[model samples]
Target: MIPKKLASSLLIVALALPGCGLVLENRIERREAAAEAAYPSEGRFVEVAGRRVHYVQEGRGPDLVLIHGASGSTRDFTAGFMERLTDRYRVTAFDRPGLGYSDNVSEAYEGPFNTRSASPAEQAAMLHRAAGMIGIENPIVMGHSYGGAVAMAWGLRHDPAALVIVSGATQPWPGDLGLLYNVTGSSLGGAALVPLLTAFAPEAQVERTIASIFEPQEPPPGYEAHIGAALSLRRASFRTNARQVTGLRPHVTAMSRDYPALRLPVEIVHGTADTIVPIDVHSRPLARQIPGARLTELPGIGHMPHHVSAGAVVAAIDRAARQAGLR
Candidate 1:
């Protein structure tokens, strides 16, 4: 249950934003330092949907495409993870429609990233197009949370080498609007209540919450800066978040019906403790409904296990990849 006092307090904070933009200088300072440190600078930029997408590909073998969750960019899945896979498979992760450096089409009821990008079907198709643009044929596809839905939709239509989901929802999705409006609130609202949500120390907790997908409970010292950069430098980040809440709900519902027909070597991963997008809503049902799906539930992890529990997530991906005979 959301606290009345806290909600009211946050709303007051919301009243203060010049816009939903957070601070950027601090965040960029951190990314330039950490990303290059994690992997050599082989970042590739491409044009998709009338916008430029930032992506990173490493290693050489069967291609693996990663789709990130709502309001998240490819950065959510760091290059460090790619480094681990460097010797074997080629890995690719992209900025979703409105997030990151992708096209900023997150207007309410607008074209592209509005509802179209919100729909798993459309997103999956777009992701496939992006893959073709990058010249990756029959790439293994993977996604987390909302990204999981897009990946599932894509995998269903076409046979990927394999599908790996980390806390990925295979069925429909439900959004929390209270959380949505809160994100739309001013930067102060985000900062003040962020600590409240995570129970972390109060300073910059909101940014930490966003970055948590990449770093989880234990954030690297400068990651908070990246959150600020994402919120501030990138205009569409929060707009996309609100749109995900208002627009994606029905698409998720629509996608749920397709689970019975889900055919592929698929591995679904989730954390039972996930407060966001509970497993019961879709993941579990899809696991049961999809003819040959395998479910792996991580006991104490949360939604972003790839970031929160990297070792376990990587192991799961490796298992799924092996199951698909990538080795």
Candidate 2:
């Protein structure tokens, strides 16, 4: 017989697992079905250095370059920011090399495999070329998560109107990471983990993940359908991103020193309660690093404020633009 306390605790733990997956996989979910809904944002690929890069264009105004994080595509930008700001600005989102519709720079990557380019610096260069190919000049470039590194790298080269980092992994901050995260996010961490989970992870698990990510948001209608779509995103991004752990984290460490060199007006938004990409790694340190940067922290909010607090995200972007004289 199950002891009452033991049974109660076990039940609570069982209920908590799904929620954990969703919260951890925000970038994954953002790229899946939710992206497909933003149709006619359309797939437009261009040749850059003999590589095929996928991109989406929307609206008209000063150009806005939105870059997605690791294991993500332009979809994150299209859904999270572009669709919302289209009326006032022209937004362009792209699939970074090795992810989504974008082709790999080298069919054979060296040493490590990853959803992102070898270095954040390289990813930013590719993005710069992509924008130039599409006629977006000196646009406001915004990056989230790994994309934040790319955005900062790009800003360093070109004089942009402004730069925005959202829940961005600005620099490595210390924290407790569960074994599962290390296995999923670390380079050479493990190979069998993905295959094992993909083969055995259940639909119920995916659904619970969705609920957990949204947490207090109350899963809206047709949410379950969205969760299933996320599963089909092809585990390549996940696998590569898993190995990208060491490659990208080191980049973050080096980038911290270079932050002060960026003269363009900058803004960073972080959630107080963010579990991933801790607030200290980015918002606070970055604000201090950049001579005149502004940091905004959302109380009780987690990493993806775009979902938990849409209005605040919008306001932050607009505020950053205004501060930089973008209007």
- TM-score of each model, in listed order: 0.74, 0.77
Per-residue lDDT of 247-310 in model 1, one digit per residue for the tens? 5667767766777786667777888877676778767887897877888887766676775566
Give the deviation of candidate 2 from the true structure as CA RMSD: 8.1
Whole-model Cα lDDT per candidate?
A: 0.62, 0.65
User: Candidate 1: misplaced stretches above 4 Å?
Assistant: 1-42, 104-117, 173-176, 182-203, 208-216, 220-233
Residue pairs in steric clash, candidate 1? 27-225, 27-226
Best by TM-score: 2
Alpha carbon lDDT of residue 301, candidate 1? 68
Q: Could you give candidate 2's per-residue lDDT for residues 1-327 as a string of tens digits?
A: 112343344334434565556553564345544534543235699888888888988898878888877656665554445668888878888877666666655555422223333577777777788789889976887887778877887877667789988888878767544455454444432233443343334556556655655444545455344223242234454455444444576787887887888887787887887766778666788898899888888888776676567677677778777877778
> Model 2 Cα displacement at 71 (Å)?
3.4
